[model samples]
Target chain A: MRNLPSSEAGAGPETVDATRRTLLQTGLFGSLLLGAAGATATLSGCTGRTEATAAGYKFLRDADLPFLRALLPGVLGSLLPAAGMERDRLLDDLLHRIDLSGYRLGLPSQKALAQLFDLLNMRLTRRLMAGIGPWEESTPAQVQAFLERWRGSSFAVLNTGYRALIKLVAGSFYGTPAGWAAANYPGPPPGPYQVFNS
Target chain B: MAIDDIYTKGIADGWKVVDASTLKQDQTYEADVAIIGSGAGGGTAAEILSAAGLKVLILEEGPLQTAANFKDMNDARAYGELYQEGAGRATSDGAVAILQGRSVGGTTTVNWTSSFRTPPQTLQYWADTFALKGGGEADMAPWFAQMEERLGISPWAVPPNANNDALKRGADKLGWAAHVIPRNVRGCWNLGYCGLGCPTNAKQSMLVTTIPSALKNGAQLVHHVSVRKLQFSGGKVSGLSAEALGPDGVKRSGVNITVKARHYVLAGGAINNPALLLRSNAPDPHQRIGKRTCIHPVNLSLAMMPEKVEGYYGAPQSVYSDEYQWKHGATGPAGYKIEVAPMQPLLGSVIFGRYGEELKTGMAQLPNMQSMLALLRDGFDEQSPGGSVEIDDSGAPVLHYDFSDYMWDGFRRAYLSMAELQFAAGAKQVMPLHLDSRPYESWEQTRTAIGGLQYRKQRVPVFTAHLMGGCAMGEDEKLTVVDSDARFRHADNLSIIDGSIFPTSIGANPQLSIYGFACKNATKLAGVLKA
Candidate 1:
């Protein structure tokens, strides 16, 4: 339901400042590496993106920043227990995933991407943590057991999460510069199908 | 392939099937009798009347959903398909009680598939108390027989599935009598998805049986058209004005249509029918249009067993205990039939969510538990709060309900009975569906556990899918919405032949009774049309 302004508005200093502020507050810089590792674990659980068309693949490039921005806070909250070590590792890995300098120039293009990552992170945490007993009592071996049980199964923990993420990205892209032209979604609405040839 | 296959293929080839909400008002027409609903009563009436050569039109407010469309019959689609917002609404106080069904076939689409004729004693009670002439068991026997045959109602020939077995085991352990309740399903696969809309078309919902037959017999059904008011002239119904919901999900101009009919049948179920009458402002000196709403409110008890029961893999509801139904010296209220109900993981999560963090932990043990519902046949009392269904400025029916203390006490008793049964059945933990109370670990703890509970004060949520009585049928106009013959007291051609015409709530699933009454009423309507 959230409609973002077009890519042309990405140059606004207000938007840049806000994004930077959110990143700093949430310590996204530190959590980036861990988030990537979590995302990898999540992606492993997913069956490959069957719904995404070849053209749809391009939307993924512009989707990273917003996806990460939204995802970092939740990831940090989940990884808080080991934030000091996990934060440094996560940030390093995220930087490796994309060129931070290029993203800084085209932050709006990366907004959807950020949102998708964030969604992935949230979903991973939900599946991994849900119904598992209190974290305090969960030993390292138990956590490993939980990961093995959920992470590699064909009934991947991340399928629903990825579906939701794709839907969000689709919504955002249609509302932004990538708009209808990027996805080749029809416009002005086609007429109803005629039952008869006439 | 098969005859039904050819028939379905032919129908699918010919008709213009539109989702009710997508229906436009540009296509308006007239009919001999306009039946406003497509559930048990309305569907049967449409079939009979249409076959009898009367032009019948069925108006349903909900979309026409089929078995193939029910793959995702979870909470989201439930809101769209079922009524009372998926489960019946409780009083604002959240005492657990609910109304049922809103889709094409009404509650029949989401019902438990159990079928029972109105017991002979119940008919006698109606005759003795209300003076409802010509409605004795004998008068209704033929109709009931026909309906039963059409629905293929019969007791389960196969062994009760694992869930039912668990319930039977629990009942036997407690020395309670149990039986396989008859269901109207043919070729049931024990696919534990009845409440979510049966996928196989095995469950004989009106959508599959009566509505399809009615349509085949030339009964025109207009879905998503909500009848706002009964058009009246000279103290009789002339037609009705209905506003169709626009594609944008709001009422729009050019979407309102008026249809003229010589006869009108209000089968909008118990709740909406009365609200429609009230909104129409049709003469009702009786002031009894929306009075005497009776919901057979059910209570749920979760029995934590030692084995991984996998409760959601079988029929949604099958086993029952009618032993306590008419208990000895039962002066206050009739007892209930304890039936095992299938609750899938998602739904189980919602029910478990009510138990708070304890249930969160219990979810880890989900595969180990079995659950069942206690369905009570409650008596109608003047003290029970009556709800009025009136139209808002936008012409949508708005419902107002207040749960009575008397019903709450019965609910409490039902819950206790279930918990005791579960304990006797050797459950390690027994959880009452009471939101305000903690789950009891033992039967000894039940009294203390439930005693301090304030269902009304805390507003615990109760859901009922079986809502009956709004436009009740009786002998006199001052006492009911329609006369014994299902004719509206004031309107010449308008009648009611659904659950809305039940003078009082029957203690069982009302599908068979509704069908029987509709068939009988359709015969009467046919007699009038023939004349």
Candidate 2:
């Protein structure tokens, strides 16, 4: 029920700094398994912007897109089409929906997600936390291993991150009609009622 | 076959409905009564007050979507347009996912239509524990009956949907008490789209019922206007300031609106209601503005049935088991009510909580998936003190909810019961919807696994569609924010006629409880205002 102005959608760099500063102050940065000194030294230089990029997503930046592109295939598995225009279109639609889904969430949820996105978007934190290099250069095996590691991790934060990522991707994918055939859902059943489009 | 869009037709017929998003200039509205939301409580109050000849104004932050918008029957569209935070509202820590509606009808718009009266046990507990007055079974029966008739609530006449039938069959085999659930509907198509908003307008939701009735009674309706704060002086509300939302319905549109009313009603339900009060810095000498909030914390288990369940095609919930809901005394241990959820592919996938090939494989069996949910009755014991509503730096509501060991105990028991029930219903495989859980082939295996399974927050999935009580109601000012009449203890000429006033979680789907309570309280308020 938090009503932020539309301008807040592109939270810009200040939010990222605040999120990082809070994480440092709370010692949660160390909980990410990073040494406090190393995290402060490295993360201070990581001025990653959270604003939506020129690629036209409302919440996800350009840096976030490639990361999602690599992760989606690993998460969707054979549910997604095997490399075709159809697969590209489906992924594009899911990416857009995911953006809206994240964008519409309350400030707290958006902030927490932004923190996760920031961590993944920066290369140093990405390497330290996820053990993967550039998302584009990362192999599917690397992405799968990372997801599995997070999912099976005993740390609550990592588990929470895994739930957030998987639910967002899987929920957005399965919610659309393009993802239904894999699950054998034939849309809403035809009944005695007529659908009047607005 | 064509269901007329009640809102379009009503607006065309000269109903004073305004979409704030379309406004070009700021506006000031004066009314005899101004209601802050248009959900079950607000809808009920609006019709009653307006029909009593008072000029009522209803304001909603959500859009004025109707049956027309619901015709798509698409989960994506529905969640994006109709739900709070796109149905992504969760606890502050994200351990529990919440499903509350944000449309004109509020949750009644998308609720599964399982209408149950305030369970007598809950009413009695509120009276004895909270010193709540005039909410006993006999005192509320007439109000319940009146709303039941008004909303066309009755036990479903059709055969149970396969998803619900499994619950009945399992309970029957186990000698547990099971019964057909009463629903608030008329001419229901059994299309299993209640959660997406009823396309046929046959579910008798407030959007299609009391709202239109209130409009016809000359009530003014405004949508897409977000209330920012309630201004008050000398223990009386002065006026409320609001901002108009753009077509996107998420951000402000730069047009300010002021509402001045003789009486103000807070019917925004649990979370938002407390948030509004907190944002306004409302007078709370007892510091009880956002305490004792109760969500009927739900956990679920998915069963892969041998036959074609097709859980997506029929009524979402038509049968329920109360075998464990009130087995023990209210304060002794956590109890739960068992019901089934429709297995729409999107919802199913999210609940399945798997990835890659396992998720793909599980969803491929969607038609055969029978999911049962256990709603733990919270807020009746010291162990389940319930959560609190706190505002973030942006003044947005953040629910601080954490499960106690007692609740985990309940979750463990509920998982075992659900798995056992599924096996009894002839499920080929059953899996608790937990991150660590895998499907088991028999009750014996499921029992052993569930007993040993980790009961932590991230390990076990938790959810809640029923949000109740933050500005709790009772006679004691020390323990309650509102009185038995639903009037704010600190504010004169202000009343809370929503689920936020519940002294405890009503051990059932609370739409009917809200309707009944609002009808009684609003009627009393109307008499006072008229006099």
Candidate 3:
């Protein structure tokens, strides 16, 4: 929350780049594996290769990595073209895009990573909104409107980034212990409150 | 007489009460005590002093609004009825924000009715910090008890309204502590329109309570009379000069009224009190009259649920958490009170906004979604006492406030906490109330995403309904406009008994505390007059 106060100052370009790299290296591969595992498991109701990979990553020593791994694949797969690149090829591509060298920088890494994930979620959500249907079926007018809304000054882009991040965090943390602990969440488990449950 | 008798007896007392809009100030008037502004502080003081057989005259700038005339929570009508400028005006920047009341009853007519006595610890701090005397909690206990009884303060025992129930559900789910908020109301129908002048007259605003009592005790009130300046003679307030504005918003010719009084009380609230002093040039070289304005900045966080919440159909706010109120080493401003406030569809639509087909899907599920707000009370900082309310060359009240860095910091923290809480409490998605901002899915993402929020040089939203501490009280004339007794240091015959005299922001709804302090000051002033 201390960083939350001064968060108004625009992050330096170097900091943003470093933060991005750290998120890719630490968070990207695990999140992808988890997403693929959750998707394929929900698809066939069977523990497939994706699920085995996800389970292996989930047992990792670092807390955030497994959660992110489980979260990313589900979120990204939900955003992916249903019948396109092979799951392994997509995961590999995402890993290649990851930049992890910035993790060594002594800045508040957790907060910076949280911010990076939020920005990524915002970008992805905008894509999701714009691509309500398959890209081929989407109208030029709809695409233009989405781009117009998202494009502009750095602040406007950052705002979209933040919203996406919050959505991703909420989605990943939905039923998980880590997410619940982070939120200090107190609500009916997966349902609306019953006034007189007794 | 019973409380209800005062209104009936006021009409019989020959006080010549008239609708504020219909009132045209006479060229002249004379009274023993001329009070400006007729809200909680002024109205209470007028009642106490008049009951003691003092001839009292009360002048209020805004038109009186009765229950019959109050709009039923319609933002537009209510804005015209109670707001200073129809609610679209901005601070120094073009950021749209909310200010206090402008009608005869002042801000009380639009308050949430949350009532609390001044905390004893805060009083002790005030006494020690400002060298104020007789302000300890023990000295103020009787006043608090009296005011609470008069206002009918009670913990809401009625089943939590739907909105409040939602908050409770969320809190229960999160294992956080929450409780029913005590308010100053009797037989409230839970119509959820307190912010727009409750049409049922159930809320204990001064319009229904103090004004009638003061009138019954021989106090005369003239509304729509805009006081321009205080006439000072040898450092004592001799009279006040004012003009009556026509319906066209222009000054009516020859309707100028000069009121002569042995004593004067300035109760024009935080913003206008300092403005009036600056306009009158009442001999202050301290430059501290309008310098330390505090508005507990608040923001809303809306959550999308799977069932119908119909948030606007119940109470405006019902429950809150005090767990974070004194957190963080007890130095920084405490965390926010997560409050349940239902809003009308128009406002809700704006809040939910365009969020892809998911938002459209959410809108279709509107009945299931509920919203709660977080009001953060930031610490007092003297960045800009807010530009003093000054008459432009054309003589209309112009108010300008600069956003301080500390206040902005508080707002950021509040927004982050609210989003995190909503997501935790089973919200499918959390949307910020910012005009162009998108919804967040996770708390971690929200923190990072919000860190990128830049202070727009052009347009941004800064909202505030809590305005306090403009004409602060202190022992030194150089630091504040009023002394410990609420007496103006420069003018022996003048005093300020309102939120304007708050030494610092009290970090809560101020109505009850304002009334308590007003009663305390009035009691002291009564003794001084008799002596």
Candidate 4:
């Protein structure tokens, strides 16, 4: 159990790598929301994969991948496992679980989430809805900055999107068993924990 | 050793448990009373109606979850199997998260078992304003006592958990009126695993009590069946259509079947009941089908304590303070009840409201965290006329609830009250559950931070477990879907015997309220049929 208060600056801080350097590049140049100018032009930068994988998870369109791949390490930067195939597996499971929940909120919410997914998944729409993207080209701090902008925005729509997206990402990440160490939540009850894990 | 599931024994002993997901062909069934949901209200009603020698059939939209399927308390499994929309159901814009259950026992299987009776003021208001003749505090006392006895409900005998102790200490220091919350459990192990469905069969949820009794008395329960519409003939509900779901419980696999009964009970809680009525195009001459739906929208104040709270252990909840509930009066500023939510990881993580290192830091303090949730009472005044439930283009329910300024004023006051209470309790830092607010190390800092925080729907965190009122029971056909007798005013033989029938929010946790209401109404229904 951790004894210190949050004023103690950091907990489980990590050093960034070269692959992460690829993430810190793009900025919407202080534009929190892309104005009418974004809507007028046809976006051509939606150049990510947009299909289902062989794993056969129900949701997560191909265009959705780059956005999530960019967002997770930022939203769950320190809590998520280090950058590798193991981390990739963890992210995969997180997205899959969130997708299952999407199926449960019925068709309307499913559509709304899918629309949000579509908007964020595409480079042009991501840039338009939120001012910075091609998220792979931005650092975790920049991504965090964009999220905080949405969280502190005067616009209700931006706040709503920020809340929806982060909750899905953060919830799915922290809820999983692999993410338990950071939260210090001893896994399940003792009896059930031993039964399931041991 | 794997626990020998109670359902296995019941099934072996010839309980009429039908897995609708495995149904092969279209089959019509007949019963004296057909209940649409199988949660707290429906389960209670089923036992009573069946015991009264009325043939009963229950259709549950969610799968039948038992000890066999509890899945080692994994939230992922529980939500998928036992919750509405996989525990992902939210309002239209997704501002408020709702946590209603969807399994055979409905929310009773998943609720934190704090049982509270309908407050005297609320019952009196119903009687005075809503044409409820015999539903005043005095008139309904016997029914309340009966359900309380039946459910083994009593004030928790054990000490409050550390998380709850903080609330008690704060209330005591401030000389506020706090009380031990009564719970519906027998031989409880004091485990905080109630939301995942009780593993030890100690919690007397309808899943363990009434549903089993109903089944024993020849009631047939079909799980994974979706009841679509109530078909009417001769001004009464004659039949209803249902589709059997597939293995996944979402896709329709079996042929459609119609159920006919002398009486039809709609116990699909608030959202689904209103959605069903709207879809069937039921006559709402006054257009009050889904208006005035109330949710006890809750806000949390997370207090990082100096000692280890480990809120995830012990009883989920056992203490509460109603000091502010009626301080401003029922009709004055919206009153709120103070309580704590168990910091189970999934729900706790989302409630923390941060990302990256910030969340990581907060997560590390989980053992030392004590949080208080102020369930801001809605629907008493015009300021909180309450949210409405409307259907989407696809006939699925879309709840539209926007927090008004009056409600925000109550929330602001609630944040201040909770922060003061937390500071008074011990050495700690407190933070309102807002995206913008940081952990304030002192009472003065908390007060200042709460004052400046933006009070908007998406900006602040909000949640509700107590979903109440939609097909409100009233005498005036223009104002309510059902009358005080719980019978649909426009349609004979149709009765809403659940939380939806509440004319207003029942000022406390609603399980006991629903249980008592069902007992009274179903008993009356039984008497009417016998006559």
The docking quality of candidate 4, as DockQ, is: 0.26
Backbone collisions counted per model: 37, 0, 33, 9
Cα miss at B493, model 4 (Å)? Answer: 1.1
TM-score of chain A of each: 0.22, 0.81, 0.24, 0.68
Candidate with better lDDT, 2 vs 4: 2
DockQ of each: 0.02, 0.53, 0.01, 0.26
Worst lDDT 10-window in candidate 1 chain B: B1-10
> Which CAPRI category fits model 4?
acceptable
What local lDDT does model 2 show for residue B385? 87
TM-score of 4: 0.92
- With a 3 Å backbone cut-off (N, CA, C), the pairs that clash in candidate 2 are none
lDDT of 3 by residue, B157-226 (tens): 7777666776777677778778887788888867666777766668888888888778878788887677
* Candidate number with greatest TM-score: 2
Expressed as tens digits, the lDDT of each residue in A1-198 for candidate 2 is 122223222233444556555445443323563343237447576444534343676677777788899888878878888888999999999899888998788766776776677677676668777878899987767888898888788887777888889999999999878678888998877544334442
Residue-level lDDT tens digits of model 1 in B73-189: 343345324554323233321333354676778888888788889877667756655567789989999999999999999887777766677777778887888877789899876
Candidate 4: tens digits of C-alpha lDDT, residues B221-322: 998888878887778887998777777876667468789999999999999999899888887889889888999999999998999999988888899989
- Candidates sorted on TM-score, descending: 2, 4, 1, 3
Candidate 2 versus truth, CA RMSD in Å, comes to 2.5
Could you tell me every candidate's TM-score relative to the true structure? 0.70, 0.96, 0.69, 0.92
Q: The CA-based lDDT of model 3 is what? A: 0.59
